[model samples]
Target: MDKQGANMTTNTRIYLRASTDQQNASRAEASLLEFANLHKLNVVHTFIENESGASLERPELFKLIAASKQGDILLCESTDRLTRLSNEAWDTLKQSINEKGIRLVMLDLPTSHINLSNAGDDVTTAIMKAINSMIIDIMAAMARKDYMQRRERAAQGMAKARAEGKLTGRKVNTVTNDKVIKLLKAGTHSWSEIVDLCGVSRAQVAKLAKVVKAEA
Candidate 1:
């Protein structure tokens, strides 16, 4: 930590998220740890989850907020990692964070980096906070826009495929499917547990379970 911020006691909660189970939420864990170490920030906990950024249904995120107290730092790799939520959902999330007096810190946002160090005087702090908040809002909006555009493109592609009579559902990952079948046959793991272990959705597990039962 910088000597200027050494006098302050800053507790940080690191949050890591991946849009899908196939992606490794902890991919940035080492970098985040280095960042906390470099800033001498006390990391109270690290929450990792595989969930869509566009949704407010992330259990781990809410748990993180619940665990945090006033003046605590909620650190992440980027604003997009924290949210690609719709405007209304984003507002709700922002309200929750603000109400808890938690500081939002993203590694990609330079303006937010000041949060890791001493914020100087009250006026400076206020100004910095305002600027940081505005920038974060802008970034969050951009992230949402990008997410929307991607979804639109995907929809258009699917439509085009259907028009061409070439539309088919996504190909099954046979290896993963086979694994799911084996686990279902073993009958030891719960559906939720299998989803976590196989990195497949609960619906997929259920479908596989049906297939296993039919074969039996």
Candidate 2:
């Protein structure tokens, strides 16, 4: 609604994600809302989810992307929150965003922030987009590296705990397992839909499928 730097007005979609359920996904919502207001960008959608950045199965993020159009902004708190995907996954996501012509603006990457201005000059806009794309690529790589390092460290710690006889894997959630089994046995919904319905992963659904078949 409000005109920003380039005399062009566009809506912004705010994406907030946390790697685990324990983390508060919407913790940065207020700050992002303030940022949008200060920049004169009208925020049309706010999608928040607890999802692993290493995977691209984020339903909410995809919904936000699909719902957006050219000239619309995709705002995130940081690159890590947006993605810690492997190179291939990151490339896929980047391609989709570019193909949709959505502008990605991350707070941690100030280089992208300036590109959102929509300068009204084709040449300047093109230059900025190219620069911002490179910056995004580098940031995504760093995020993925950090993700891998953290995972490695955690794995090492678990191994040490196991060696000391102090490690025990998390208990399966029987309630969720039961729900997944029921959904799988019904054979009505797709695996992805069942995952969402039962709040379980596809791997869990596969495991339950075996149990259901064996019992049938």
Candidate 3:
């Protein structure tokens, strides 16, 4: 559903997101609402999450992906925020959207809006899809390269700190972990639920929550 959409009449599921731990999430919504208003469409839902776009899996993004229907329009503030990962993952995501018959909207990429409505169903549209897909492929590659460069710089900084013997690696905070115990003993929450609530991944949560349960 990576359509450059046009004249969308259906109520769109406007997804606004910021892929950082500290960055503000509200900024994604302001202009998207204006676009929806201008197009005379209703925004049925908005999901915002403070997570990295490089994360191959995200809770809110998955929920939105699964919830999308034939006529659903998945709106995002920008394409890079949807995925700034490897092209393979991006391809899978796009394939999933196409199979589900969803539409994608990007304020930063207006041509994507037209791809949503009338493009894929015709020969001319098919040609346009290829060209646009190529552009997206190029963009995704650049994003991956930039991600690698950033990681390299961060690694160099950490290495220097380690050499200076002044840097310590992150430790799991005890007080923060204690809340995971509270969630499990007081209510019937799933392990995954505990992970989300604790803002830790399931793998780490499994190791910790199990110990807390055994002691209790």
Candidate 2: which stretches are off by over 4 Å?
Answer: 1-9, 121-125, 168-216
Error of 3 at 141 (Å): 2.4
Per-residue C-alpha lDDT of model 1 across residues 1-216, encoded as one tens digit per residue: 212245547679899998865678999999998989998888878999987788786899999899887788999999999999888999999999999988888987889987776456598888988899999999999999998898799879977987897967887698999999888877789999889999999999988875554320
- Cα error of candidate 1 at position 42, Å: 0.7
lDDT by residue for model 2 over 1-216, one digit each (tens)? 223345536778999998666679999999999988888787878999987788776899999889887879999999988888899999999888888878889977888897567667587777877887888889889988887887789879977987897967876688889888777766689999998888887888887775554320
TM-scores of all models? 0.74, 0.73, 0.67
lDDT minimum window of 10 residues, candidate 2: 1-10
What lDDT is reached at residue 141 by model 3?
Answer: 73
Q: How close is candidate 2 to the true structure, as a TM-score?
A: 0.73
Ranking of models by lDDT: 1, 2, 3
After TM-score superposition, the amount by which residue 132's alpha carbon in candidate 2 deviates from its true location, in angstroms, is 2.1
Give the candidate number with the greatest TM-score: 1
* Total clashes for model 2: 0
Q: Pick the candidate with the highest lDDT.
A: 1
